[model samples]
Target: MSSFVTPKKWLTVPLEDVILRIVGGGTPSKSKPEYYQGEIPWMSVKDMNKHVLQDTVDHISQAAVDNSSTNVIPAEIPIIATRMGLGKIVIADFDSAINQDLKALFLPTEVHRDYFVYWYRSVAQKIERMGTGTTVKGIRLEVLKGLEFALPPLAEQRVIADKLDTLLAQVENTKARLEHISQILKRFRQSVLAAAVSGRLTEGWRSGDNPERNFKNLGEAGVEVKTGPFGSALHKSDYVNGGIPVINPMHISEGTIKPSESMTISHQKYTSLEAWHLRKGDVVVGRRGEMGRASVVESDEPQLCGTGSMILRVGEDALPKYLEIILRSPTAVSYFNSDSVGSTMVNLNQKIIKNFEVYFPSLSEQTEIVRRIDQLFAHADRTEQQVNNALAHVNNLTQSILAKAFRGELTEQWRKDNPALISEENSAEALLERIKAERAAAKPVKKTRKKAPS
Candidate 1:
């Protein structure tokens, strides 16, 4: 026996030589009542969203499985999410039926199964590139079967597969930890926003024991509140490429007037209606879909408004930043949504928003409050960034680990320690010989049969 640490043996084989059987999944007819309910797991792409989806969310009766063209994939068959998620692969633990488009792969070659799975996972981008159809994108079975891969020798394959499994395990653990941290950070931000709007955030900044209330209704808070007046005149074609971005309900998010994906209103249109150009410090609140969600205009540069959004121009009496925070508070969000009208497309009209009550402290007090909100929000933003960075790092680590595993590096340490697993000859070749022998021994016996209508 050689004492040369890890084995140096390697080989390459075609995927077509090793692929055992490939099957396409099926879906029972939704219209048939008999196919509606059963113990058998009937899975769709949506069913795979759940992290631990061993059993499916829905089931179809055995009769449905029998009547439908969909075949029942046996246990341990690997199913790939070919349509929606594209490359998301899951090993089915129970007998289940899948949507027709989702490809199911069963490894007949036992030793190569793990290695093939790892290799297939490596080409996620290639798999995504094969996106088909104009509507719901999919990778057809013919396309999937034709996928080419560079396969190493059997002993090397085992080494690579083992290493990849360990590295992926670590990456998955890191990802789980980051996900938990993200949830905690999200909750903290939500809590801070809740406290700010509820008047609890500034609890300590009270007036003296006898100091008269240095406060005014929001109308005196140093800003004017005006809505967009050109609601009826807006059109889709009045949009430009670079000038000012148009604001819509989609742009009017919880706390700010984010620019639309599209730009708007060419110079001619703006010149034709100079009064419609928006200024900074203006708050745009949603008028449809999710009514009353508010956002502030971050840019001093020009912008235009759409029919589905209302532009709130702040007057000199109110602090735009302070008012913007208040609008972002949970209380304000709830208030606007509650006061909103309409069933199909909910909206908070200009009249209701203009008449809405707002509370404010004195100018100096307002400045301090805004400063504190800024500090707290900045802190929250940092925490969020940290969680995001951690998550990103975990994702990168996972890809690296997976890449290293397929490269025959991960199992090097293990192979060095357990030299007994290393054989003098190729392991895959021995396994392949055994399979051929079995097939040769099972030759069909010849039998005489009576001739019919000779």
Candidate 2:
């Protein structure tokens, strides 16, 4: 239903005019278990995800088909959802029985199957908007039939469909490669973190005069661990808008503090709970929910830790950034998962955090480790951003190509080169007449009975 101008020599008509018949399907009785346990492929809205369905999740018996309102659609026929999952169209690879929500469109032989499929896809969003319902939205048959369909010459339809197939397939392959690269970047970052914390990253730097690394409890390594204010100490009523911000577990992500402005306390309330205030160089960690969720307080801003978080103040011997890296490493995450308390929701206390053992290297070595990690992470962030942008463009390319095809822009040159094929007997108008004749010939004739009783 887009306002795209019709191409020259193309025929514009109602969608139903080109189709021979439209058949609605039904589900077999669930009471009969034997009806479901069979070899026949039975389709529903759930099975209509892919463009071509090779098989269905559910199957039904032929007896079920005989007894139910469902009909067996021939292979490669287009089926669309009228009820739930509106705007989806698919073709079955085999003869399949459909449930109540789907309708099979029987197109005339004059129409190219792939061409119709692509055309429907271009207008699918328009169809979805016409759907009406309170709970499950659905389109009426009349609404679907009333929509405009632009038809090109049969030969042109084939050319457009062939072009779309090749172009869309290439787009899909590019997306797959980008997605694979994204996963590789994730693994690369994890590997870097693992190496940094285990002394493997700085091993070569220490080869000349290797300094002894000692294993020590976090409390013994000049780190002060403290839990946030409990629910009794800071009530929900204390929170206010445009006040001192509160850093909860959700606010700590990607090794940085992102406090919520709305989840804050007034200056008066903050003064009373000043003991839980966060200072610059402090590490705020999530003590509940996900394990090893920690971030560094990069600024000396007015912020308070929430009930579900803990704070760690590193002494002169330790670097806060380096400690944050160790906490986010795979080894520390594994330890937190195994030792944390509670069943339904995992929780960590000051005692557990203080007793956690970690490698304690010299201050100079910690500085070097933090610098190297920052450089590597910056590179990963840049690469990830580029990949994300490319992915977004690739996603849009599909609809763009589809729009161009429907607008006749994709096959503009073909139209000029093959003018003879689109004229006279080969025109879309001529094709529609043939389709109409085919429909009239396929209709069954009803016999009249003589009145014998009279």
Candidate 2 achieves a global lDDT of: 0.90
lDDT of each: 0.65, 0.90
Evaluated with lDDT, which candidate comes out highest? Answer: 2
- lDDT string for model 1 (385-421, tens) is 8888888887877666666665556766765675554
Runs off by more than 4 Å, candidate 1? 1-7, 29-39, 50-52, 55-58, 82-84, 112-116, 130-167, 205-231, 236-244, 253-256, 261-263, 267-276, 291-293, 351-359, 424-426, 435-453
Q: Which segments of candidate 2 are over 4 A away from where they belong?
A: 23-49, 54-75, 82-86, 94-102, 128-138, 209-212, 226-251, 257-280, 288-292, 299-308, 339-355, 417-420, 441-454
Clashing pairs counted in every model:
16, 0
lDDT of 2 by residue, 1-454 (tens): 5476768788788998988899989989999999998999999999988999999999999999999999999999999999988889999989999998999999999899999999998888888899999999999999999888888899999999999999999999999999999999888877888888788888888778875556788889878888999968999889899999988899988787788889999988888998999989889999999877899898877999899999998999999998898888887788888889999988998788788888778888889999999999899999999999999999999889998998889899999999999988999889989989998987778889878995
Query: After best superposition, candidate 1 residue 24: deviation in angstroms?
Result: 1.0
RMSD of each: 5.1, 4.4
- Candidate 1: count the clashes: 16
